[model samples]
Target: MSERTDPRVVVLTVLLQLAQEARQADTLDAFAFVAANSLKRLVPFRNAALWTDRPARSGVSAVSGVAEIDPDSPAMIWLDALCRHLAEDTSTTGPMGVRPENIPPELEPQWTEWGGPFALWLPLRHPSRQVVLGGVWIIRDTAFNGAELALLERLGEALGETLSRHLRIGTTRSAILAALTRRRLAIAAAIFLLALFPVRLSVTAPAEIAARDPMVLAAPRDGVVARFFVQPNQMVKAGDKLFELDDVDVRNRHELAIRDLAIARTDHKRANQAAFADPQSSAELSILANRIERAQAEEIYSRELLARSEVVAEKNGLVIFTDPADWLGKPVKTGERIALLSDPEKVEVLAWLASTDAIVLRSGAAVRMFLNTAPLSPLKASLESASYEAQMSPAGVLSYRLKASLAEDEPPPRIGLHGSARVYADNVPLIAWILRKPLATLRQLVGL
Candidate 1:
């Protein structure tokens, strides 16, 4: 045989080569796999496993000669339990030989079924910090000598340094992944429970305080509005002068009719006197009488028009209209709406609900109106009726007209006060309520 090389030199050569290989590993998992399988080059072993203490409990991360690990497998499960039990023993800080008698009674059967006659536990620790990062298990039929154990310890330290370097590079990511893995089940359970929580399905819409079953005041004459006796939102009593039309045309007609009546009466009086003297004059009296009757009818009609020129409130209520400037000198047609006489105490909530947000509202769905003037104090109301068809609202949006009655116990709001309203429908799951709008939009886009 050729001259034998010194065993010390051989061991040193192998240790250096393994250290270089560990350093070259690109990831922590790669380094762990190399550490578990490559130790056989210096110390012979039939099987090997690597366990990490990164998590709360130690877990077997890699197995020698196995490309993928099935965590549920009996062997892996047993090994994981064994690693967790062994990690709890703080006294075993260094390489220790594990024998059949060394294992606890609870794990004795599993150890006997899967372990070899001799097993060596090599704790991987930071060289400078001396903190345990992980461990390696070597199983074989024969006992591990002192020299081999010493070499394995050096190898463990080298591998641990390499692992720590990779860990430091991805410390944030590793910590996040470890935490997520540990609490994944709890997080999933919490989310599932939250999705099933019951919530009231509701929608928001623009609202206004409106008159409920109030009298509408329309223009009674085809003439220019000369003056307004009552301002917008002014309280007025029955027979109060609300507005007046320009009386110039009606007064002119009245004067003409009065003059014509005077002329016809004068002519009639002369014919009646002449009829007693001349028979032919009596025929003229009949014609003159007819002319007087026609003039009387014209005078009466003009007098009625003069009376209608002045508008009056029919009932005692608040008068709601636009700015007085908009109506002054503005000519209006007969029967055209000009103002509203509303009872302030009998007010209602008028909401313009968007068609997209419409739901199956019950007869008495709850409605909360947040008025612009007093948003802090919302007015409670109950839905009374909703329009069957959507119409253009005053703001020019297509919306459904919803009328709700304000709570009788609460004082009614002033007419025409604007606000926002929240209309609540039937109860549904929280997930459904959250996803309602998104799903509606998706359906519209997809035309499904």
Candidate 2:
């Protein structure tokens, strides 16, 4: 029921039977050992070879039996193309025979252009039935006839089956390893999530608020701010004597003016009363009247200077900064700042806004500010004023000044606390909120 067995057929069949058993070996090393021995015994070719496709490897054969198959050899052109084509087509029988139509255009030229006189291709079929496992290529210079072709077919089939089996085992082994790794990672993540893992956030450039108190205590006279009776942070009421300057010279001048005025007044009264009785008293009366006027003017000026010596607080507030204690004896000019006081309760929140946001910020827009130290608690406020012009920040970013008054009563804010606020605007999608920057960058680059 079949072609009669010739001596060559008998020997080839027996060797192939043994080779199939040896090729059936599980390990690639074992399969290779069995295949080489079988090929040498069955065929008269000077050299026998086996090839396989390896992940992430390119050019020439990744796994090869022949040492001459250099990794970078140009001879790999045919093998590479054959392997790629076979890797995609899993249904076809490898090395049984291939029509010119069945061969891909990419490999058609290589079949003729390759240096080898004969070449064999076998698809390493996958056992999972998902896709082609890969392909193997056997090349030689001497062409074979029908009998030799048959032997090569059997060899290719046996090799393909062996590769398929090993590949399945390899796949199973890889899947197990991957599953174990995933389980370990999941456990680690769970443990980390349960512990409330703390994330440390640091800010190199923190937000700053600028503020100032309009109430300032100034020196009332051209005298040193002597005897500073109050220190910074001390509370004082309106009209409280803050400090007193030395008034010894002014007091002495005032006393001298008073004595001169007394003598002039006495002479003027006697001269005026006697003026009607004697004509000579008229001249004396005029001189004494002039002297009394000069004395009164001097006395008034001296009295004003003495009154200015006792400086008093203008309003109720805590003093922020006062003149240096050592500067008590030093002379000071009029209108010089001696101390600063501010009502801590009348506080306003100062914030920086980008020029773009500043344009949209109205005078009554709502704002919620959070101090860096108390991030969880927010201070409600409303925009009171904003500067029209923008200023360049120290880091060269352009921003505009914004001011707001606290809407609720809270503890007095520290002068230099870092803070930020959300000036409510229109809401957007969550995806847009997260990927806005990256998407904007891509759009800019691609001109989309």
Candidate 3:
């Protein structure tokens, strides 16, 4: 009633018996160690490599009948391609065997150089043959015969079920809990220490680097900008000609005023001579003197207008704005903003703290700034002032203005550079730190 067994058949039967001991897989190492070592005894191969399909833990490999296997070696590449093809293309009719010349052109050169064995790619599929859990690759000097391939394929179904147990995420939860039980005291102590820890609470907001003392440069008169002596961000000293206006109209008025003043003086002198000749002409003499005085005032006013056309810088600083094209040939009314001159040495940070996050902020709080351009190195600072009321930000949100002074030892940031700011508040319990904002809002909302 029973079939007789050959030595090879007896070895395979023993190998299958040893592998079936895996009741429910818990780890890849235990399952792989049993299967790979047992397969090496039954199969006539120089090496065997087994791997999983998951990306997170795929790098580790278990080998049998060989001292080592390099991941970068040609054998590994061929194994990778075989597994991928087996998993992706189910159209392959049945278990396939590869001879030496059957390898792809790209992989042939590397395979020949290694002088390795003829590799076999075996797919371990589910019992129903619906899914593949993983794969096995064995190597030998010659191509495996049909009877040997059939035996390997028959063993794949049982191996797939056992391997799938280890691939599951929840299968090891009971094992993890049991291990944690042995160290329960240590874990409990760590949780207790973390709860009692007091830490400073901090809030981050949008911020910008601004000049401490910014001077407003404006149009001196209602005229077009003729020329700019310096470009934007150029350093200028007091009395430096910043720009010139169209002075043709003012120059013409000055010339007319000068000619009128000379004529008025001559008339006044002739009237004085006539007044001495006749007493009745004294009234005419008074009128001519008044005309001469009026002409003198007109001439002075015209001269002032000509001087005002050429605007000059009043302080030493850098002019901040766009290029020359924005100013040149642009008509501006008197007192219209031209640009801002900022002192490079005197600079401060202006942070827009959102109203929701500004409740915890106080004067003299520790502040840290990271300019967008230099994000790695944060600039140390201290809060100087905060607005009593909220104002609309450029981004259309109501926020409070906060001023901060940079550290004395640190170099000043460039004016108008925008970045982020973090303000550290008072220390509190870990629980309070998490619930601080929500509690404040609750009190304000319902007076709780």
Candidate 4:
């Protein structure tokens, strides 16, 4: 086999070289490398300077390794103008705009200076799609034939494809790196939130007021039934007589005893006087005085019996219960209870709550209570540091007693007022709402 030296072969070989150059350069610096190396194989200007045109910019980097030249240099200015023309044409006519024979007069001077009569300006397309993005100007010494021009066009195409591939890779890599950085910041933000905002814990329960039951008043000794002066539920002051028993018999006995006492006194005085008058008669007088003293003792006993007829209240309260109204005229036994009284102003609100709903109940919890009849208003209350012993309600339902005290501004909750209380507990994590019951059950069973 013989190596083909035909122009077509040359063109194909050079185009392949250009594509390889672009593919090899991964970074933006590879642009300089690609332009420099790819241009070396073709017959172009002796020394090539890559010129990129902005509004007023000239030559940027040189492929021929020449000394830096002023951007204002005539040759450099012409090169920039040529690049600008190529850029404009490619923008309008797509990537195949620049060809060797179409060189304008103003750009000729720069081509001549760079040592090329025919040159090709190829546009580097963006990685997104096939289009003329920027121009790649090549320098050649002589006017090239159609075959050479065709070769340069093919080289441009390969360069465009390669550049597009690299641009896509660069864009994708940048996007991935940005995404990673963003994710890291998000994680940090979550951690910061956890530290700055902490969860709080608190105890909660319903409350109610409690009072001691009324003290019992009972008879201390056996006595006849007294005549009652007041009816049930009547209020009485301490020391006021509540009932009076018949004392006629005891009163008569007391009067007889009083007369006997007076007679005893007279006899004792006579005995003493007799002893002073005559020693011989003193013994008989003393015997009479002894009998008088025995009679006087009986009189004192009758008087005491008469004084026990009246009954009195021990404390101030309404008379809660009275057995039979006619019992006042009958005999009464010792230790018999007369009445029951309870404090009125110091009453408590006994709120019954379902056991399941009372799970959050705890001492010191704050609550708001509203009577069933007074639903429009609420009274503030606090847990009274105690709870009722758990028991079944009258209706056979499990419930707990919540004792609450009215706040300073509120009136004491009247006894027997049916009301409900709302207790405030600390906020918990949102997830706990679903898991609260199961967790509580587990803890109870495991004793954890």
Winning candidate number (TM-score) = 1
Among residues 3 or more apart in sequence or in different chains, the pairs in candidate 3 whose N, CA or C atoms overlap within 3 Å are: none
List runs of model 1 lying over 4 Å from the truth: 1-182, 262-294
Whose TM-score is higher: candidate 2's or candidate 3's? Answer: 3
Over the stretch 1-448, how does candidate 2's per-residue lDDT look in tens digits? 8978799768776766865675558786566555544565666544344555544453333333553445455556655665566566656654534444567786676556552455555555444444344454555656666776666666665566566565454566457757888999999888656544443211112244433554777777787655777776678999887788788887898999999899899999999999998999987877898999999999999999999888777888766663456567878788887766777566667776754333355677777778888989987877787777888755476877667777766666865567777665434444444455577678779999
**Candidate 2, poorest ten consecutive residues by summed lDDT:** 197-206
Candidate 2 at 208: error in angstroms? Answer: 9.0
**Reference-based lDDT, each prediction:** 0.86, 0.65, 0.76, 0.61
Candidate 2 off by > 4 Å: 1-30, 34-48, 51-137, 142-161, 167-214, 221-223, 244-309, 326-334, 348-404, 407-409, 413-448
Clashing residue pairs for model 1: none
Error of 3 at 9 (Å): 72
Q: What CA RMSD would you report for each candidate? A: 14.5, 10.3, 16.1, 22.5
User: What is residue 431's positional error in candidate 4, in angstroms?
Assistant: 4.3
Model 2: how far residue 15 lies from native, Å: 14
Instruction: State model 4's lDDT.
Output: 0.61
For all candidates, the clash counts are 0, 0, 0, 10
Instruction: Give a tens-digit lDDT track for model 3, residues 1-448.
Output: 9977798768678557756754344677767766666676556787676766763645325677544568776566666665565556454424556545765566556665543667776676544454555677666788788877767776665676677667662335445655777579778887777766798989899999988869888888888888888888889999898888889988999999999999999988877888877787778888888998999999999999898998787888988877889878888999998888889988988999888887567788899999999999999999999989999988888999899999998899888899999999888778777787889899889977
Question: Using alpha carbons, what is the TM-score of model 4?
Answer: 0.33
For 224-278, candidate 4 gives per-residue lDDT tens digits of 6657777765778777767766677768878989998888788778777878788
